[model samples]
Target: MRIFLYSLFLLFSIVSHADGERVNIASFSQNDINSWQTKIFSGETHYAFSTMDGRTALHANSTASASGLFRKVSIELSQTPILHWSWKVDNVLTGADERTRAGDDYPARVYVVFSGGAAFWRTRAISYVWSSKQAVNSHWRNPFTANSQMVAVQSGSERVGQWVDERRDVLADYRRIFGKEPGKLDAVAIMTDTDNTGASASAWYGDIWFGAK
Candidate 1:
């Protein structure tokens, strides 16, 4: 739409780094790549998992919450950073927890915990795809907020179904939601379990990295 085009237009072409370097820490390793993230769930192939055509995730008939995140990079709690990525939903089913909560998300989500330290555990949901009920009428909305009642993660755009980049400042995002500065960003986690009901669901992730501007 005109909005996305405007976003592309208004978006800063100026590199955050004057030296023209990308600010990435750790990320998903395909070949001999490694970083500092820990495994919350090591995924395996099963009924919930299907290898059709070469895609990887914890979908129905796949394993447990084994969605992986590597290059477990950390962003300094200051210097307002941006987290960017290109992604979209492939499918949606039910979930592990069973009973739907605010999200009503079946084939649940893969969340990232952005705690100040290992002891803190505040998370950002990767989000859900359009259900037969909800049309893709809603485009992307920055600063999506979620709570106990329902989730406000739906954006308005569906095309650019291409490799679109989404950038978010970790500091500003956390402060807006939690209402304060953060501590030490411990580790980033990728969780693909189910709803609290435990029906079995998941999401997919590609190269994920965090850095400064």
Candidate 2:
């Protein structure tokens, strides 16, 4: 909810392996490993792609102002890293969003949590679309809020708006989508709505670099 260090607004990131295969956005510096610990979950002013303000029945589009909207960030990669980032989502056609609904809407996620936190996707590692308005290479059938999940990877298409590049190999993408082998990944989160769905989504992020191979 609130954890601040500002660490002078952290600025010093690494993109090693001699920066070979195109994935170096200003040599990484998304507030230095997401500022050790940050999680908003609910709202209090934070936007990069919809933070929150409530509407219902749909007719909204206002979320892009969180200085660097971060749902959660805190990394500790010691050896076993290979995660990349770059997203751009826009438009899913009026009324309800996050994938579709007129009365009970919900859906929107992108996660990776491993601090032995017990559970939140059965060991945490989700890339979601449980239900709602979908488009742009859309394909549905992933309803997992944690049902003894062993892995849930979604990315065969639907880069949402545009600009796409999400190459994850953080220990085989968490052992092929949460199967096991998450000794230490610490933290990395970017979520829009996951408190039990209230779709009104929006997104835009770019270049998140990792090392240790």
User: By lDDT, who's the top model here?
Assistant: 2
Runs off by more than 4 Å, candidate 2? 1-68, 71-107, 113-125, 133-180, 193-213
The CA lDDT of each predicted structure is: 0.35, 0.37
**Alpha carbon lDDT at 148, candidate 2:** 17
Task: Report the alpha-carbon TM-score of model 1 versus the true structure.
Answer: 0.49
Best by TM-score: 1
What's the TM-score of every candidate structure?
0.49, 0.24
Model 1 Cα lDDT, one tens digit per residue, 32-99: 13443333333431323233235432222333333333233344546435555434344444222212
Cα miss at 48, model 1 (Å)? 14
Residue 42 lDDT, candidate 1, scale 0-100: 34
Question: TM-score of the candidate numbered 2?
Answer: 0.24
Tens digits of per-residue lDDT, candidate 2, 71-129, equal 23344444536666655445332343332222222223344445434332233443432
Candidate 1: segments with Cα more than 4 A from true spot: 1-21, 26-33, 36-72, 94-164, 195-203
Q: What's model 2's lDDT at 205?
A: 48
